[model samples]
Target chain A: MTDRYKYMEDLLNRFFSGETSNEEERELYRFFAGEDIPAHLRRYKPVFSYFESGLEKELNLLTGEPAEAAEPFRRAMPKRRIRIAAGMAALALILSVAALLFLRKANAFDPYEGSYIVRSGVRITDTSLIRPEIEATIQKALQQEERANRLLLSLSASNPETRIEQIQRRINRQNEEIINRFPNEMKESIRRIIENK
Target chain B: MKTRHLIAAAILLITGSLSANLPAQETLKALVKKCESMDNVNTSVVRNRNKQTKKLEKEIISLNFSNNQALVNEFIAAFEKDKLMADKEIEGKNNGKKTLFYRFGDTSYSFSQLNEGSASVSVIQKDEYEYEE
Candidate 1:
C-alpha cells in the first residue's frame, strides 16, 4: 500500500478510538477529498465526501436561499410548543379559581365550621356554650350595679328612680360593650336573644 | 301525746319539702369538695383576669378521678340533681366521646366518663364585670 493510504488508515483508527486531533482529522479529510482512490479504499470514500459537503455549506450561506427556506420550519416548532405551554397555564389558573370559589361557597353555608373566638376569648364552634357565658357576663354586671345601687341609696339622699335610671344606663352601656367584643357568630346569637326578648 | 306526734310529723314534712327544694349550687360544691379530697383525684382551678378590662374573666374548676368509680358515681348522682334543675342540658361530643353539659343561667358544668373508670368534670364560670378593688 502507499504511504498516503497507510497514513489514512492510522487516522481512521485514531478517529474510531476518539484519539484523533483536529489537525490530524483535517489532514485525513483533505487527503480523502482528492480523487483517484485505490479499489481497497473505496469503502471509506463516503465519509470524506460527507465532510466535503459540510465544508461547502459556507457557499450555500453566501447564496442565502436554502437556509432561509429551512428557517421557517425550524422557528415554527418552538412557537407551537410555546402556545401549548400557555394554554396549559391558563387551564391550571381557571381550575384553581373554580376550586377556590367552590370552597368559599361551601364555607358560607356553615360559617362556623372552623373555630372562632367568643366574647370570653375562648375558641369554640358551639354557640350554646357561648350563650351561658354571655348571660353570666350580664348577670355579673347587674350584680355589681346592684351593689352600687345599694351604696348609692345608703350614701345619697337622692330620688330612687334617678339613681336607678343612672344604674340602668351604665348596665346598658356595659352590655353593649360586651356584645360588641364577641365574634360574629356569638353576636348573631345575642342579637337573636335580644329580638326574642 | 297524740298531738305531740302530729306536730313532729308536720315539722318533718316541712323540713323534707324544704330540703327537696334545696338549691343545686350547694350540692355541686359539696360534691366537688368531696371528690377533690379523695385519693387519686386531681383537682385544679384556674382564675384569669383581663388586664385591659379589669374584669375577672374566667374561673374554671376541673377535676379528674382515675380508677375511682365509687367517687365518680357519687359525684354523678349529686350532679344529676343540678342537671334536673338546669334550664337545659345540651348533649355534646368531645374527642368522639359523649359529653353531658348542664347549663345554669350564668355557669356551665360539663362531665365526661372515660374508659377504665376515669372521669372528668369541668365547671366554667365566666363573667365580665369590673369591680372596685
Candidate 2:
C-alpha cells in the first residue's frame, strides 16, 4: 500500500480504538467516503458505509444541521445523563451516612444521668439529705459550747480563779473536736502543723 | 436486786418529770428582773433586728454606774447566777487602753476602759437558726 493509504488505515485503527479526536474522525470519514480506495482495504467499505448512513440519519434528526456539528450534541446527551445519575447517587450516600452517624450519637446519650458535688469536690448527691446531717453537726457544736459555758459560769459563780482551769480545758476540747471534724484537706494541714510543732 | 433497780428507775422518772415541768427560763428571768430593778440602768429589748436566717432577742441594759466597782461586781454576780454562762474571756491592754470580752450561750459581753477612766460595756446575743422568715 502507498504511504498515504497506510497512514489513513493507521488513523482508522486509532479511531476504532477511541484514540482519535472529532477533527481526526472527520478526516477519517472523508477519506473512507472517497471513491479512490485501495483493494486490500476494500473489506472496510461496509463499516465506513454504516458510519456514513449513521451520519446522514443524525443530520436528518438535527433538521439539516451538518453531521460534524451535530456529533457533539449527540455525544453530550449520554454524558450529561450519566453525570446527573452519579450526582444523585453521591447525594443519597452522603445523606444515609449522616443519618447513621446521628442515630449512633443519639443512642449513646443518657438524659437522666447526673453528677453530684458539694462545696468544691466533695460529692454529696442530695442537698436535702446532707442538710440535716450538717445541721445535726452544728447542733452538737452548740451543745458542747452550752455545756462548757454552764460549767464555767457555775465555777466562776463561787470563785473566779476556777475559770482559768476550766477555760483552758474547754478551749483544748473545742480545738480538738473542731480539728477532728474539719474537711480532709484542712485536717491534713492541721495535722502537719501539729506534728511539726 | 431487780426490785431495787425498778425503784431506782421510778425515782429517776419522777425527778425527770419534775425538772421538765419547771420553766426553762425561770433562773434567767429572775436575773433579768433583778438587773432591771437596779437604779441608773436603762433596759432595752430588740427582737429580729438582724434579718438573717434566725431571729433573736437582744436585751441591752446600759449601766450609768460605770466607774463604780461595787455596782460592776453586783452585775457580774447576777450574770454568773443566770442560766447562760460565759464560755470565753479575752483581755488585752495597751497604752492605758484596757479591753475585756466574754462569750456566753450565743451571747457576748465586752467591757472596755480608756486611759481617761471612761468605761463602756456592750452585750450582744447571736441568733440561733430559725425556720420561719
Tens-digit per-residue lDDT, A1-197, candidate 2: 49989898888889889999888877877877888889888888778787768757776777975666777999999999999999999999999999999999766442212212233223454534554444443343345445535655675676666557767655443433334444667776554443333
lDDT of 1 by residue, A6-104 (tens): 878888888879899989988877777777677777777787777667545656778774744677899999999999999999999999999999999
User: What is the C-alpha local distance difference test score of each model?
Assistant: 0.59, 0.53
Off by over 4 Å in 2: A1-197, B1-32, B50-64, B79-85, B91-100, B112-119, B129-133
Q: Can you tell me which runs of candidate 1 are displaced by over 4 Å?
A: A1-197, B1-23, B91-98, B128-133
lDDT of 2 by residue, B1-133 (tens): 4665565456445544544333322333454455445444433222223333223334332223344555455444444443133455555566855555556545555555533534444444545522110
Residue-level lDDT for A57 in candidate 2: 74
**Lowest lDDT block of 10, candidate 1 chain A:** A111-120
CA error at residue B52 for candidate 2, angstroms: 9.0
